[model samples]
Target: MSKVVLITGASSGIGKSIAHYLIEKGYIVYGTSRNPREKVVNGINFVALDVTKTETIQQAVKEIAEKEGKIDFLINNAGMGITGPIEETPDDEIKRIFDTNYFGVIKVIKAVLPIMRKNNGGFIINITSIAGYMGLPFRGIYSATKGALELTTEAFRMELKDFNIKMTNIAPGDFATNIAAGRYHSPIIKNSPYEKKYKSTLDLMDKHVDKGKDPLIMAEKVYAVMQEKNPTIHYKVGEFIQKFSIALKHILPDKVYEKMLMKHYKL
Candidate 1:
């Protein structure tokens, strides 16, 4: 029997790539996008559902359950990127980021847990970023949301281990995705009294994000995780250099890592 998988934010980038690969792997994929009018990608089915809407969540679940009978995997991949100095970033932008990145995943997980538990087990892959591991200058807000997701993923993995729920977080280095397009956000300095405190650092981050890895590789990581019987709590993907940097960051003193980030980013 083929495993049934549903991926949110499935219209493009990593989610879309994973959908293509999984269908090739024989999983029955039901890909969701905020809009229903996506061009048909051979091998996967697309559905309309916005992660931000609870009714949309219920509707997708009801429809999928009717057709597939059970869902074996749920990829909470619907998220956006917002890069700007915390001080100058708009209050509204901060809320939008969290709503999509953090709460959106939570809503989907809550809806799927019961169905997964009934079947004895299922996998939950949360697409996080390396920023989840370290704080980059202007990426502070984005990092914070992913950091929160990292901890949440861990808790789910441990708490649901006995229930056979497998939760995993995939943290990729800067990827060549349109997430940068979504980076049009106000700097935290907008409302801050200390706007001058971090202007240069914020600008530094915006520039570095331009130099990210190809997003196609990120899709491969998602497909590989699907083949694992028991994936790790956190999997790092991307170029060898970024992987090395993460390893170095893990082993070094906080100040050393901070200095490297500052210098490399020209913060």
Candidate 2:
């Protein structure tokens, strides 16, 4: 039987690309959205799931399991973006993003674990961000959420080992996607201390996404990782500079790295 793959947030962007790619490769793909207009799209079996809602997450997983009899792979790709100066960002907004990007992922994993364990084994791949490796100026909240998820996956991998389940994190750099349109932007407050610099940084971030790599690159990378028998704990997919920044942080002095980032963001 072809492997069954479940991908959340598949209505658009990177998740959609991954769903299409895997379907072409002969995987039985179930792609989800909070609300899907159609039950299936271009070979992807669409399911309704809201990452922030535990009920929706459980229902989606149960629906897929009943139909397929087993879920061989789960790509936790459901996440939202937030961009703003940390001090200015609303407390409610911060909590909302964490609920979607961090806690939501944990809920989905919890819902899927039983089927994977009963089926003998499975793979869970988390879609994180390269930004997660380090905090960026205006994008701090988004970075923190992904960072938390990244760390959680490290611990999660070990705990799942005894059950023969494999888990890993794949952090991708900016990809050309509709993420910018969907992300929450803490309004650019007039005359606030961070106004000018925050505006500039936000513009630069949009440019990076506009020129970022094709989502298919991430799709291909996901496919490659799935073929691995002994997958590593973390994998990054992005431009050399983005991936290199993570390495630079590890080796550079704290102030030096901070300076480099400040210089890059023109803060």
Candidate 3:
């Protein structure tokens, strides 16, 4: 029997693309969506799951485990983004974003831990972003959430070692996806002190996203990771320039990195 795989936010974008890729590779893939539809891609199964809801996550895992008797790999790719000046973004908006991007991930991992533990081995892949390595202008909150997940996944990797389970962080720079489809914007941005700058910066941000590489590249990277007996703890996917940017952030001085980011976004 093929190894069973579960992916969240599989209705579209990276999640959906990866699901199709894995299906083509003959993995028994179970993809989740907040509101699942009858849409089918090859043999990938869509399960109704809202990462933020513990009950739904529990049920989805239960259904999969019951039928497959094992979950060999799990990809937590469900997340949303928020944009605007950090000061103008309301506390509630930040909370909602974290609830979906950070806390929701935690909830799903917790729900599946027991099954993986019982099985004695499994792979958990968390979808992070290049922004996780550094805060971006106007998208600071979104950065914070991914940054939190990055650190969290690192800790999870260390702890899951004893169980023979593995955790990896897939940090993609920017890919053409509808990830921004459900992105939230601070209502007060229009009247804020940074209003004009925020608008221009956001426009530039959208332009970059529009020209981003196909998400299938990331999906192929994901496939490569799945073939590994022991994948790297973190894999960065994107254009050479974008991946180089991540490397530069590590070696460059704080001031230098800030200048680079500012120049890229024309801030």
Candidate 4:
């Protein structure tokens, strides 16, 4: 029988691509989006959802579980990016980021756990980022969310192993997606003590996103991991930089790496 997959943040970028890829492989994909632009792209099904909304998360799970009988895979692919220095980032904005990127997935995972545990097995693909493995200068808060995800992934992998539930993290290094979709909404950091530092960082972040790898490629890797019988806890998807950055994370000293990050961001 084909696996039943539910993906959050399915409106665009990597989430949208994963939905398409999985559906093509004959998996029943329930794609979630808050303001979904276009629904029903060939092999996919769309469910309107806001990841930050408890009511939406609960409702989406019920709809899928009732219809599909069980959920074989859950991709917590919905996330947002927040840049600028911590001092410049307002408390409200930081809370907002954590609500969407961190707590949002937590809600989805909690809602889906019983279904997967009842079935005794399934896979969870959490779409983290290169920022997950190593910190970036301007993306202070965005990196925090990814780091939280990476740690949570490890905890889930260990905690859920006996139940046959797999938690795999997809850490993509600069995949081309709508990661910067609503950057203009980012609040001004004028009150921030580190305004200058954050401005430079935001500038670099905006400049580079257009040149990243296609998100469809990242989606394909996500597909491969979902199909694995015994998947590793983490896969660094896209480009050699993933492998290199992870390696540097191990081989290089802390200060050395920080220096490199500064140089790379031209900070």
- TM-score per candidate, in order? 0.89, 0.99, 0.96, 0.92
Best by TM-score: 2
Q: What shift in Å separates residue 201 of candidate 1 from its native position after superposition?
A: 6.6
Q: Go through the candidates in order and give each one's C-alpha lDDT.
A: 0.82, 0.95, 0.89, 0.82
Question: Clash pairs of candidate 4?
Answer: 176-213
Model 1 root mean square deviation, Cα atoms: 2.7
> How close to the true structure is residue 254 of candidate 1, measured as C-alpha lDDT?
92
lDDT tens per residue, model 2, 1-267: 999999999989999999999999999999989889999899999999998999999999999999889999999999999999899999999999999999999999999999999999999999999999998998989999999999999999989999999999999999999999999999999999989999999999999999989999999999999999999999999999999999999999999999999999888
lDDT of 4 at 12: 75
* Clash total of candidate 3: 0
Off-target runs (Cα >4 Å) in candidate 2 are none
> What ranking emerges by TM-score with the best candidate at the front?
2, 3, 4, 1
Find the number of clashing residue pairs for candidate 1.
Answer: 12
Compose the digit string of candidate 1's lDDT tens values, residues 63-113: 898888899999988888876667667888898889889988999999899
Q: Which ten residues in a row have the lowest lDDT in candidate 4?
A: 182-191
RMSD of model 2, in Å?
Answer: 0.6
Residue 105 of model 4, lDDT score: 89
Model 1 CA deviation exceeding 4 Å by range: 38-41, 187-211
